[model samples]
Target: MRATALSLASLPARPHKTADLAPGTPAAVVTAPPPRRPRGRPRKTAQERSDGNRRRQLMDGAAQLFRSKGFAATGTRDIAAAAGMHSGSPFYHFASKSALLFAVMNEGMASAVQSQQQALAVLAPQAPARECLRVLIRHHFEVLLGPRSSFIAVMLYEWRSLTPVQRRRIALVKDSYEAAWMPALTALGQQGLLQAEPGVARLFIFGALNWAVQWFAPDKGKSLDELTEQALALFIHAG
Candidate 1:
């Protein structure tokens, strides 16, 4: 009995791995929570995408009608028919014919500004100012008279058709579009190629260029290149 008790006492008790843990304390298991969706208004891109497609169709249809038929003569039904929509469909995108007109003008000016900036971007930084001016004039001609040029054409003839509030909105975009010409005109003036004050020169230059929409006949012998050359000769010193 004594030998048995001594042998049992010699065996060490198993080590207590949880000795430091307080009684009844459960181990915590951590797991990441699921991602939360943004509250208040679900994703709008999907909605805008659908609206955008229809809006673009409406604008394109309106542009064609406003170009061929005068803005005054064109109606919402005509615009909707051109776009392959019901007569009442235009009201979904635009409130009225005048609103549609404003959108076309604004879009036209915005497009013009973007194209001009892009054209200038590709030119070499060291390109001569006269050469830059020539390129800019040519780009302007292309935008004003190129295929799908009806948008600006409508803007050119329908200025008085907009309400004063609408006119102000369109003017804001127009000013930005015209401002792109300033740097090029300034460069031309510094190079002694320009004849009039830069500001006056800009007005005269645009006046002559815009008038081309009415008279210049591409079907005949007139090319955009010819117009650009003539404009340079008239505005810049030949030396």
Candidate 2:
């Protein structure tokens, strides 16, 4: 099972109460969320921007390698070479392979979280509880069905590798993301509108959205709109 921010969140979850999307927004275009640039590093200049882009490419290539194969199976040389750099490129941007793995996962999750927040923002005011959920589901699937799906699955299975300190820090950002949907779910449940237990509702909805990483292909009639409609229909009628 995937680890959702919902299962063990410490903060209160709140669903959006209103939304203002143009009725049909593509998941890929949910607003260009700012990428999760690594901190502890100074901002880049024009020259440095080129270097940063190169470094990002290396990290992205490494992530692809790690996701397609297991971490233990991929070596630094493979990643560096794939990124069009020598065998030491990953070390230039990350401390070690573990750091690179975490960074990739962190960036992917951050992008997803940001997209969710953007989608939620449009719905946070007057959208019905159930309607808000359908929107959330759509954005979630859109974000995952892209190339980052592999990283997502890797993160799900490799979280145990994170250090204790790293774990908590990641948790903080993740909690905020999950909390976006909690308010509406809780409110609906209280009103006898939720389909099942709170945990189940949260898990099932998240699971359906998350599962897109497995077999969702744009060519199989599984476009973002189709998934969005299906998810909305499933959850809305479940009660």
Candidate 3:
């Protein structure tokens, strides 16, 4: 239970970018950049290439199974079978179910972050900030409440299963990303565009967005677009 508690206590990982340090920069001198990983393992044998492909296939299958069923209820053989591997095959790729869970959740979270960034980019040039926020809100729901909802589910629920170190690592990334929204949101309220309390707007906005996973049903008489419109209207009214 300690493992689960740790997972619940924090988040997962993220991508990295190289700092701009030319050969002679002070930082570069102190620490020569790590050796570049060769692009592909020096021309692997045909069997090695096939094995690498199979490992990827297994991980993908495992992710899908965990999403459809809660992580705890999902067995390693279930993932192996889903990947068309022998019953014991998942063990070759994942040391334990929690490891597999971490891999799946990490991937899904990264994808979610990417999608949100892309959605916000659409509104960057032409739309007003309020309108842009509305679009961002709607698209965020599309990912969370619609077909791509599984990642958010894992993030909100299954995180408690991670190692403490892993949990802290993920939490830092998740909170940092969440913190990025504040500047824009604060600007809106400061400019008198949104009638929201600056200090509390993030909480309310996220609460509204996250709730979509429960009540949001596709083809449930109301379309997602309509739902977005209504939600935006409600927020605007309060603002």
Best by lDDT: 1
In candidate 2, what residue range of length 10 has the lowest lDDT sum? 17-26
* lDDT tens digits by residue: candidate 3, 33-151: 24454565554443333434555566577666665676777888887787777887566656566656665666556666677788777665766657766777777777777765775
In candidate 3, position 204 carries an lDDT of: 86
Candidate 3 global Cα RMSD: 12.6
For model 2, how does the per-residue alpha-carbon lDDT over 1-239 read when each residue is reduced to its tens digit? 22353333323233221111212311121222255566656544433334346656765786678767777888999988887778765575666676666666666677778778788888758878887877777777766776566656666656676666555555666677777888778877877777677767887888777776666667887688887888777776556
Tens digits of lDDT, candidate 1, 1-239: 85674455445343222211122233232111233554656544434334235667778888988888888899889988887789797776665676677768777877887788898888999988788888889998998999868889888889888776666666776787788788878887887788689999999999999999898777787799998999889988875
Best by TM-score: 1
| Model 1, position 160: C-alpha lDDT score | 84
* Candidate 3: segments with Cα more than 4 A from true spot: 1-60, 193-196
Cα lDDT, all candidates: 0.75, 0.66, 0.63
Q: List the residue pairs that clash in candidate 1.
A: none
State the TM-score for model 3.
Answer: 0.69
Q: Whole-model lDDT, candidate 1?
A: 0.75
Off by over 4 Å in 1: 1-52
